[model samples]
Target: MADYDLVIRHGLIVDGTGAPARQGALAVSDGRIVAVGAIDGRGETELDAEGHAVAPGFIDVHTHDDAAVIRDPRVDFKIMQGVTTDVVGNCGAGVAPANDAFRAYYAAGMGPILGESDLPWSTTAEYFAAVEAARPACNVAAYVPHGVLRYNAMGGERRPPGDAELQRMREQLDEGMRAGAIGLSTGLVYAPGAFARTDELVALAKVAASYGGIYGSHIRDESARLLEAVGEAISIGEQAGCGVQISHHKAAGAQYFGMTKQSLPLIAEARARGVDVTIDVYPYVASSSSLAAMFRLGRGAAFETAPAIIASVKYNKERYEGKYVREIAAELDLPIGEAIRKVLQDEENTPSVIMFIMDEADVRRVIADDHAMIGSDGLPSEGKPHPRLYGTMAAVLEKYVREEPLLALEEAVRKMTSLPAGKHRIAGRGILREGWQADLVIFDPATVADVATYAEPRQYSRGIDYVIVNGEVAAEHGRQTGARAGKMLRRGVAT
Candidate 1:
């Protein structure tokens, strides 16, 4: 008879605790890690992990995979890259609490980034249940997206919420929190959410705080107004008395190059003043978002100098997919702004883009920050999606740890695992401790690398040898096992 369910032996353990690496064997039993270090017990199944790095499975703390998990339960892009958990409903965008208004919003040009789906629920609890019914390959946690709340309550009204609307939004957030949402997230750069004032945000943050949740934000600006935006996020947290997470922290645009130097300090100073705030960044120089929204936010200026590649378009797939917008404009014989308007109108304002705007130096600087964690921020849409969706975790190990060596192997694992697990309150996972859930990744650190490129963005990653979720092998040797061991995690509750 086997003494344990599984045992992985002789690998270098980087236990996701920021601890020094050590050679050891680990044992699992009934979906929990029963032992770490020397393990003499025999197991029903075993894997020899010699010469590889065995660490906790990566936790993607920021993602927009709310619709992807339900639409395609396999989630191969995340699992193949060794991500065991995905925190969705990021940047205040989600398809949850699917009321009439939310359904209309999804139909009204949100499909390019959020993916098209028939929203089947009217509450966050129902949404979580739907995710569970789909049996995603990785665990999922979520935020009650402020944008959805606004749309549900006010229906795209571009003004401060009236008293009745404010209360309605508050009630929805309360319901989501009771259903185990991790926090309240706002995309202040996007409309409806953008229309809200600071005090309005403070009110909603208070609701999340009451449920012991944090506040995450895609701030009002990431360009010249970055500092002001950062201040507002901090103020909201301080006033609401909750922790804050700043999503995909970067200064985008040529003039704002290297602005993280200033923004990072501002974050540090806020911490000194008793603000509980942290940041997450993707390991890429380019960003992707809805073409119409960026243009409305005055981000189109960057497109004038740096060509923007159309990542997805419903109307003109051959003409726009994977082509630069500037090239499209050249063909049409129109100015850049006019061309963008024409295409947006034709596509029903649903096309997304990959815009090269950030500096590599700034990306390195932000990633090197001890308080900064990693998130893919990848939009899971059709037609040439950003490569980060397929490659973020692997890229961190290959580029940031092995190639340029910005972070030590153990420290980087901490950012991906325990750092996010602790901040987001994902209980009983993210660390390889006895009695913890057995979510893990075994990989050859030397060979681990992201093969997905901007041109070939959908390719799977390389060197992730095995990905285990809750003691079941979900993927092995770059292939999925068709085992869906994932769960929908609730705040402060073990899966």
Candidate 2:
């Protein structure tokens, strides 16, 4: 019998620690990396990884795949991109701990993003059980979404919660944290959660902090009030005594271009003051969200200057799906704002949109920041969802490391792997070290690229040769092998 379950040989090992690459071999046994940098033992299976960069599998720290894992177990869009772990329940959107009211609310408002209306679990623990039963293609970690708590406690009331309501929300959050959520996530721009004040968030965040969890937020505004939003997110973490993760940090709108110049420094200052704050950035300039919500916030003015594409629409598929807002307005022979209002009114505010809002310079600046990590923030809606869903990790390697060369291959791997794993407290899976879980990816550094485009958003990425999850080859040659070797990761719990 072979000494190990698997061995990968003759590859350049990028250990996910921002270390220099070195030619070596790695060995795995019983789902753990048993050896690295010169494996002499024989194995039951061997892969000749010549001309590839073998590193820890990418960890997607920002995703809304709360329902996708159960609805579609393959999750090829993620694993095919060498993402072995997905952190779900981002932007305060999720399907768990649902009552009938929240269920109905989710079916209507969050279906475009989460893609499922039928929520099978009523508690976070039950939800995790369902994830395990689904046997996903990649591991999953989750956050206790603030929106769910708010809706469960207050039924979309546009005011501060009374003392009783506040206690109810805190109780629900505490239940989720005890069930192993990594942190609390808030989408302050969305309803109910949007109604919540900074003090309200700080109260719930304290519950998560007591469990040693972090606080992640899609802040109140990303356009004109971007600075104030960042300050609020930082303040929540400061008061709650927890780390903060700013989701998809960006300055949206034409006037706010290059705003990260100020925002990034503000984050740095907070860190100097002993507040642990880090931010994640998707590489794309366009952002996806509910069309109605955008119009409600008066963000639709961006469509007047730049293009916005309909990502998913519950009705009027032929008229809207994948078409630009300007194009649709021309078809209707109406003004841009009028067209937006008509669409939301017609679709009942259910259509999702991809807005070209942020500047490329701002995106590049954020991606190049040392303290910043990578997140796709890709909304997995049905029609023409953002290409970042299928292509985020590969796109970073292709654009930042190979094309403009703004980052070295080693540094980029660090951002995707150890940096997020450490920050999110995802134990024992982000690095290829002895005794660590053997979740890894092997790709040709020169040819690794994102093939998925806005027009063809479902295409698999290029140059990801092998994706191993828990010592099993989950995907090979840009295709899923149908291996379900994933686990439901819990906070402070070693996998």
Which pairs of residues clash in candidate 1, taking residues 3 or more apart in a chain or in different chains?
none
CA error at residue 480 for candidate 2, angstroms:
1.0
Please identify model 2 stretches exceeding 4 Å from their true place.
none
TM-score for each candidate, following the candidate numbering: 0.99, 0.99
- lDDT (tens digit, per residue) of candidate 1 on 276-391: 99999999999999899888988878889876899999978988889888899999999999999998988989999999999999999999999899999989999999899999
Model 1 quality (TM-score): 0.99
lDDT of 2 by residue, 1-495 (tens): 899999999999999999899999999999999999988789899999999999999999999999998888899989999999999988887987888899999888888667965887788899999999999999999999999988988889999999999998888889889989999999999887899989999999999999999999999999889999999999999999999999999999999998999999999999999999999999999998889888888886788997899988888989989999999999999999999888988888899899999999999999999888999998878888999999999999999999988999999999999999998889997888999999999999999999988888999989999999999999988778979999999996878
Give Cα distance to truth, residue 443, candidate 1, Å: 1.0
User: What is the C-alpha local distance difference test score of candidate 1?
Assistant: 0.93
Q: Model 2 scores what on Cα lDDT?
A: 0.92
The C-alpha stretches of model 1 lying farther than 4 A from their native spots are: none
